[model samples]
Target: MENKRTEISDLGEFGLIDRISQNFTSVNNETELGIGDDAAVLNSLGSRIIVTSDMLLEGVHFDLSFTPLQHLGYKAVAVNVSDVAAMNAIPKQITVNLGLSNRFSVEAVDEFYKGVKAACDNYKVDLIGGDTTSSMSGLVISVTAIGMVGQDKITKRSGAKEKDVICVTGDLGAAFIGLQILEREKQVFMANPDMQPQLDKYDYIVQRQLKPEARMGVVHELAELDIVPSSMIDISDGLASELLHLSRQSGMGMKIYEDKLPIDKQTYDTAVELGIDPTTAALNGGEDYELLFTVSMDDMEKLKKHADIHFIGYVQSSDKGNIMATKGGNEVEVTAQGWSHFKKP
Candidate 1:
């Protein structure tokens, strides 16, 4: 049976908003009011609130040919939440603004919201309000997440001191390698429609690309362990690029051991099969959404036993420069070749 398509024009904006608003219920007490109002209200929560927004364009940020609407919706919320977690904040609310073209139907929007609701549930956040409007060409998603952190507990990119232990949560490069596989399979499908996608074997890497989780678990664990990262950022634009962000903001140099970099077995194997240097992918492949942070040496023992946390390096004075010690005993300046959305073709 074919899915029924209800045109946005037929329902109009108010009707569409009504349909969407009915599907969501506020989960956070901080969200005093959600949807159907001129503006949403949030309680003070007795802490500093952090806000972050991200925009995703159709062809630029994603390819719908291989991307599922459900995953895309989840990712949009997760990425924003990752930013809040990087600041050592607890996410409370989000407002999503979507630009849809006529190509999308009510069913498509419903699928997208289902993913959104799932993310809200997972992150313990409330959907306060959002706007939906027509687009000129393709789909556009903009999400703004609001979170709270105590003044003393908030982490910034500029807090690293010399010799602070650099730590990263989880493995890397799987998402980028997954993208390579998806692109390859997309090409194959375009060439021959009858060929089924060879994706079952690449499930881990593929899912990493599709549905990434924010390191809220790490944040919560850090709080439980009574440890606060000196500085932190999510690995959204690859490890190397984010490391440079810390370097520049904190006015410190970094020394990371190449051997200490985290790469999953699946990511490594796939990178090699795709002829990409696994280390390079770990360094420059973006969208891992793992937390990269620094902690005082005194706090190292607290995290040493944690299986997913890897101590990759230490911070140094700015005069020493940003460098990575390779496995072959050579040191090279870390370069930023991660995602550059504005880079010209």
Candidate 2:
């Protein structure tokens, strides 16, 4: 009873971030970007600099179970860039910090770097700096990205207005389902070493979990069409959570249609196979990494024919309430049920 120790799992991930960053204070005025949005924003002469950081852990956020190191490295960077993209900025530089245990070899570390290099090339962001340290447990990778955009062009989660159309890019729920599949496969392998995984049917959902794209492609399309979203957030959380964030910031409620929600055929089929409600997965599943945004009705013409983006609903008066009219013709209030890492097991 004299000596005591506590487990980190008790604090959860976001709690750890809050505890660590609480003691930190803003110093330099030029340190415009810090720890809030997808990235931080710095003030510059003609442009506002953007910054953001993320850490991927071994057992919690990611499982080395069925995931390859290279994809893990690439995904870590893409997740950060998705934040930068959420700000409507272009990524220019990044710093990577790593915590490795002796279990990983020099060759394994090289493979991780190879993935990082691929992401840098894809996003046109440079690998500027970082630190490599030892960890007693498994691998940990933290990335900080810096980008820039004009002050007038900045998009936060705070600009939606009533009547602004709610839009979502790509589909939803694939990544979460993919995680389920991977976990299932891993258990099967552990149960019988000779049992080969029948993964051919789940390849798409599996890749969605392992190799999520940042949707910079959609950003480019929005730019080419000359439309900026009134408010925006990437869907790292569930669609419901991100929608509520935009609503609170804009002082409005939202009205989205369940019939209009986009779920990939593969995702739907697999969700049913796993005995999960496809609608629930689409609503509350996290880490799809697509952009959830609001655009003025006038900008609608620009994206109407576009393939990936869907006009799911519109911002409404908070007095009217945030509700979804299901495909079955019933209305229900939207709620935030994102992956609560603090979730009781």
What TM-score, over all chains together, does every model reach? 0.98, 0.87
Give the 10-residue window scoring lowest on summed lDDT in candidate 2. 1-10
Residue 311, model 1: Cα distance from true site in angstroms: 0.5
lDDT of 2 at 219: 82
lDDT of each: 0.94, 0.84
Model 1 lDDT per residue over 1-345, tens place = 036988878888798888888878887778899887888999866989999999989999999999989899999999999999999999999999999998998888888888898999999988888889899999999999999989999999999999999999999998999999999999999999999999998999999998999999999999999999999999999999999999999999999999999999999999999999999999999999999999999999899899999999999999999999999999999999987887987
Error of 2 at 31 (Å): 16
Candidate number achieving the greatest TM-score relative to the actual structure: 1
Would you list the clashing residue pairs of candidate 2? Answer: 32-41, 33-41, 39-51, 39-52, 40-51, 42-49
- Models, CA RMSD each: 1.0, 9.1
Cand. 1 TM to true fold: 0.98
Candidate 1 error regions (>4 Å): none
Q: What lDDT does model 1 reach? A: 0.94
Clashing pairs in 1: none
